[model samples]
Target: MTNVELKEKIIEYSKEIGIDKIGFASADPFLTLKDRLLEQQRLQYQSGFEEKDIDKRVTPKKLLPEAKTIIAIALAYPSKMKNEPKNKKGERRGRFCRASWGEDYHRVLQNRLEKLEDYIMSLVPEAACKSMVDTGELSDRAVAERAGIGWSGKNCAIITPEFGSYVYLGEMITTLSLPPDTPITDQCGTCNKCVEACPTDALVQGGQLNSNKCIAYLTQTKDFLPKQYRKQIGNRLYGCDTCQQVCPENKGRDIHSNEEFEPDPDIVKPLLIPILQLSNREFRENYGPLAGSWRGKKPIQRNAIIALGNYKEESAIEVLEDLLLHDPRPIIRGSAAWALGQINTERSALSLYRAKETEKDSDIVKEINEALDYITSEVRYAK
Candidate 1:
């Protein structure tokens, strides 16, 4: 079969295998993207989780030497949960971002890509291809936008006409020179809801994102969340969806075509207090399947502590104190200290004082002292 025929066959196969959208693009270097990446590096806007080498990120040929065509795929995830749990006063819950609502999307996208790769190899036995999901050297959004899968939105999410911004993207670079698709025009126009609604102002302008200020990036970080963003994190345990949630394009988009993308209410909106006390193995068993858990238990536990403080659930004070005093990870201990201060009860103040004396880590000690100062200020102000 000709490359044209093979491309059509692949598109048909993609639909059969449940890929929501598939698009093709030339394997040319992403020249504009390279410039933007360098600018992001210069401005120190990267999330640190991104692939550092801009060359590998921009040049498809670097990834697959014989690269001629790129295939971009997007899988729609559920935007709204069914029978979602409610966060009551004492029984407060923290939320994993919608992208993380169901199974780990990397696995879901990988399964589909692997099938496509196998099918392509079967058709052209000598075809060379390399597939990657979020962690890939090449940016999935850049590939998708170039392949006409979606337009790059102001929030930096690829916004599909059919599924809006609520989709998981992955791509494959191949030696088969399939016909490239036309990129979609930017439809954001004058609507700046996503940029204005960002609590941290991570969205610099229309297409630029400062990942360091992004709450989604902050939530995944293993270190103590910066003080300003901690309060903004609210009940988010894993990722932030504020930008997408406020986007006019994503307004009514809620697709549940993939069962793997369907959320388990209990897991996605898990109770906050229990998370603090969970053992590492227990955490893995409970949360390992979700994409949000990829950073392991520390970040989630720390965020959970912050959420508890945000809620000021008096019931959580005991557990937060336990973590503040006993948790080995300084991030968790320090976050717990901050949370206790946010709670700002007499018991929390006393706990911070007791922990302050025993805490050897300079940062944790500083956090404890700061928390104590906050409580002292609160008490003095009240008097």
Candidate 2:
């Protein structure tokens, strides 16, 4: 069959296998993907890698020597959820981000793309296939925009009129030169809400995101959190969704999905008490499939503690007390101690003072002492 026929077959099978939208782009490759990645890295914005990798991703044939066209797919996720039930008080907003609320999307898209490849190779038998979803340098958003799937919103996400920006992107690069879809025009005219709403000022002028200032990046990233950003983090434990949450264009598109994208009811507004007591294994089991995997449990637990501290949930002092002495990771323990100090409870204050008395590690002991001082201003205990 011809490449056009292959494109048709791909669209048919991709939709059949549960992808919401499938569009074709001649692997013109990521013109901006390479440059933006390089800019991010040069500005020290990347998770890893240097300018060289970014260069390759931006250049078409350089990225995939045999790549001809790319098949990009978008999966919509639920944009809204029921607020916490009144009985379950002290609930924090989601840290999992809107896109990662359900099953691992990487796994979901891989299964479908592999099937599409199998069907194509059934006819060609010699075509090469490499599927990627946020793994490599190829820009899924750029390809999606070029493929007529959607236009890139000022929030730096591709938004389909039908689904808004609450969609996940994945692509299959192959040796077939499929007929590319028409590109969409930019619709973010005179709109700056996404930029304005960003607490960290991650979104620069236009749709460009200054990664260093991006709360979503700093939250899970290995980089040290800027002093100003901690307060803005609020209760977000995983990824930040502030921009999309306030987008005017995203008012009420395909608001939710029946797919595995549905969040665990408990996850929508987590119980902070148990979260403070979570072990490494427990943390991994609960949020492993979600976006929290990258940071492990330290960040989530730390954020949970901060949320408790912010709410001044003195009742959670018991839960925080347990974590201070029992939690394995020093970061979690330190953050928990800091939280207990914020709760203004005598029990938290005494537990912290006792933990500080015996704690020898300078980093941890210092934090515990600081917390002790903050919680009990009148009690001047010698270190």
Candidate 3:
């Protein structure tokens, strides 16, 4: 079969295998992306989770020799949950971002990529292919954008006309020569809602991000969250959606086409207090399937503690107190101390004092002292 015929067959088969969108691009070096990445590095803006070798990341041939084309795939995930649980007084819940709603997208996209790879190999017996999801060397967004999958939005997300920015991206590099699709025009004219709505101003400018200041990156960190950002994190247990939520293009774009991407309300929007008590095994068993759980239970539990503080839930004081005094991890204990300070009750203050006396971790001790000071100032102000 000719390359054009094979490409058409691949597109038809992609639809049969439930791939929502597919596009093709030449395996050229992403020179523009390389410049942006260099700028991000120079400005200390990277999230540090990306592949460090710039050459490998930008050059397709380094990943797969004689690569002729890249097949970019996008799968739309649900933006809204069905039968969403309400967060009430003592039963407040924290949320995982929309991307983390269902099964881990890594596995879901990998399965699709594998099937596509198998089909391609069957057609071209001598063809070589290399596939990767979000964790790959090549930038999935850059490939998708080049392949006319979507326009790169101001929020730094690829905004598909059909699915908005709510799509999971993956790509496959193949030796098969195929005609490339035209790049999409930027459609985000004059709309700066996403930039304005960023909670931490992590979007330094349109198409630029300072990942260190981003709540999505912060939620995945294992250490104690910085004092300034703790309050800004709100009830987000994993990832941040403020930028996407405020985008004009994303308005009324709630696609639920993929069953695998549908959320289990109770799991994605889990109660904050109950989350603090989940043991390692229990946490894994409950949240193991979701993409948000990749950072393990520590970050989620820490965010859950911050969410309780953000809510000022008086009922959580007991649990926060227990965590403050007895939790082995200093990040948890320190976060608990901060939460108690946010609660600012006399009982919470007592817990901080008790923890202050026994806490040997100097950092945690500092957190306890700060908590006590916050409560004392609040008490005096009230008086």
Candidate 4:
């Protein structure tokens, strides 16, 4: 078959193998990726690269020397899960934003991409693929735009007529000389809803994602989250789907995946009480299969407590207080104390007082005292 015929066959087989979208572009490095990469570097997020002398991404040419095209693909992940309340309830009512509520799309998309790649190699014995889903720092979003899959939105996610920004992107880098598709144009149409809705103003007025304030990066982060942005994260434990939720292009798209992306019912709008009580081992077993566990249960479970606090639900007080006493990590203890302050119950007050008496960590004791004072004031008002 000619290269054009081969490209057609590859994409057809890709869809048959279960990909939601498949398009091709040349293997050249991303045209507009340097500026974004520089910014990501300034924010200190560029550590995930191979610093070999050969310019790992665009050079040494041998690995991709004869490469004529790259296949940028996507698989649709469910936009919403079972218990995630619809937008009608009000902002921040749902548990997760949208895209992340399901199982990790990376694993599922990669598995399917491998099948397609294998089939291609069978037909062209010399074909080999450096296939990856969300790996290799190749700017999967950028390449997807070039391949006519979608255009990058102000939120930096690829958007197509059918899937919007809800699709998960993966790439197959290969030596096949597939005919490339024409690039797509930006369809944002002066829409700044995503930038405006961003709780953290991470996106500049135009359309830049300052990773430092992005909740998706913030929740998965290690170390301390700056106090200012912590509140902005609201209840998002793993990823934030807010910007996409408000985008005009994504409105009313009924796309959803029925594969490994299905969520565990308990995780959907989960009760903060037991989640705060989970031991490291239990958290592993419960969330390991899900993408939310990528940072381990500590950060997510910690954020769950914060989300409960954000709700200001008095019923969460005992749960937060209990976590204050049992949580081994100071970070968790500190967050629990903050939630207790927000809930402000008598039980929480007493626990904070007791914890304050024995606590050796100065910062934690201070947080406990703060929670105690706030809760005490609240209870007094109620009485």
Candidate 5:
């Protein structure tokens, strides 16, 4: 079969295998993306999760010497949960973003890419392929944009007309010389909803993102969340979708094409109190399969404490006090102290006072002192 005929076959096979969108592009160097990445690095905007080598990231040839074409594929994930659990006064919940709603997208996309690779190898024995999902060196969004899968939106998401900005992207580089498709035109004319809606102003400008301040990046971090961003993150336990949530193009766009992307209400919007008390095995067993759990239970538990603080769920004071006085991880202890301050109950003051006397970590000590000060000031003012 000719390269064109093979391409057609691949497209047909993609649909059969449940790939939502597919586009082909020549294996040319991403020069523009290289410049932007350098700028992002210079400004210290990187999230530290990206590949460190700039050359390896921008040049496809470096990844595969015989590279001649790239096949970019997008899988649409569900934006809204069907039977999402409710958050009440004492039974507050924290959320994992839409991307982490179901099974990890990396596994789902890789499975499709492997199937595609097997099909192509059968057609052309000489074909060589390298497939990458989100964690790979090459940027998935850049590959998708070049391959005409979608236009890169101001929110830093590849916005497909059919799926809006709610799609998971992955790509494969191959030695076969296939015809490339035309890229989509930028349709975000005069629309600034995403930029404005950013809780941390992570989208400094259209098509540019400062990942350090991004709530999505912030939520995944293992360290104690900075004071200013604690309120901004609200109840988000894993990722942030404010920018995409507010976009004009994404309005009313919710796809449920893939069953794997469907969310379990109890897992995605889990109760905050039980998460605080989850043992390692219990955490892994309950959340290990979801994408949000990749960073482990600490960050999620920390965010859960902060969510309780954000909600001022007074009912959580007892558990927060126990965590402040006893949790081994300083991040949990410190965040628990902060949450106690937010709750401002009479018992919370005594917990902070006792924690302050014994806390060895300077950071945790500082948080405890701040909590005590907040409580003291509130009491004095109320009198």
Candidate 6:
């Protein structure tokens, strides 16, 4: 069959296999993306989670030799959870971002990509193909934008007209030549809501991001969160959605096309106090299937502690104290110290004092001392 015929067949099969949207693009190097990446490196704005080799990331041929076209696919996920759990005062909750609401998108997208790859191989036995999801060397958003699947938004998310920005993107590089789609026009004309709404000013400008300051990147980190951004993190346990939430284009857009992406409210927004008690095995068994759990239980638990601090939940003081005094992980212990300070009651102050006396880790000791200082200042002010 001719390449055009094969492309048509692929598109039809994609819809059959539950791919929400598919677009085709040439496999040429992403020249514009390279310049932005270099700028990000020079500014030290990267989150350090990306592929180190810039050449490999921008050049599709480096990933799949003689690649002629990229087939980009987008699957819409639910933005709103049904039967969402309420965040009561005592039973405070931490939230996983909309992207992490469901089963790991990596697995869902990979399954679709594999099905598409097998179908392509069936048609052209000699054809070569390489598929990648979020973790791939090639940027999923860049490829999707190039393939006309969506316009890259100021929030740094690809915003599909149909699904808004609530879509998981994946792409396949193939030796088969196909007609490429036209790029989408930029729709974020004068609206600066996402940039302004960014709690940390991570969005330096439209289409630019300082990942180091991005809460989404910060949440995945396994260390004690930087003091400055801790309050800005609020109740987010996994990722930040402030930018997307404020975007006008994303208004009233909550697609639930894929059942696999539906969230379990209890899991995605769990009680802050109980999260502090989850053992590693229990955490894995409960949350391993979710995308937010990829960084392991440490970051999530640490963020949960921070969330409790943000809420100033009096009931969480006991659990936070236990973590501060007995948790083996320094990050957890230090975060608990900060949370106790936020609670700022006499009981919490006592816990900080107790931990301060026994805490030998210099870093954790500093956290405890700072907590004590904060409590002292608050108490003096009240008096």
Model 2 ranges with Cα > 4 A deviation: 49-52, 82-84, 87-95, 222-227, 369-383
Q: Which candidate would rank higher by TM-score, 3 or 4? A: 3
Provide the lDDT at 76 for model 6.
Answer: 93
Model 3 local distance difference test score: 0.94
64 Cα displacement, candidate 3 (Å): 0.5
Model 1 gets an lDDT of 0.92
lDDT for residue 346 in candidate 5, whole number 0-100: 83
Off by over 4 Å in 5: none
lDDT of 4: 0.73
In order, what lDDT does every prediction score?
A: 0.92, 0.74, 0.94, 0.73, 0.93, 0.93
lDDT value, residue 164 of candidate 3? 94
Residue-level lDDT tens digits of model 1 in 1-383: 78789899999999999999999999999999999999999999998988878999999999999999999999999899889988899899999999998889999999999999999999999999999999999999999999999999999999999999999999999999999999999999999999999999999998899999999999998877889888899999989999999998888899998999899999999999888888889999999999999989988988999999898788888888888888878888988899899889988888898898799999999999998898899899999
Distance from true location, Cα of 79 in model 5, Å:
1.3
Candidate with the greatest lDDT versus the true structure: 3
How do the residues 255-296 of candidate 3 rate in per-residue lDDT, one tens digit apiece? 887789999999999999999999999999999999999999
Position 358, candidate 2: lDDT: 66
How good is model 2 by TM-score? 0.87
Candidate 1 shows a clash count of 0
Q: What is the C-alpha local distance difference test score of candidate 6? A: 0.93
Model 6 regions more than 4 Å off: none
Which lDDT value does model 4 have at 298?
76
RMSD, each candidate, Å? 1.2, 3.7, 0.7, 3.6, 0.9, 0.8
TM-score of each: 0.97, 0.87, 0.99, 0.88, 0.98, 0.99
lDDT of 2 at 332: 65
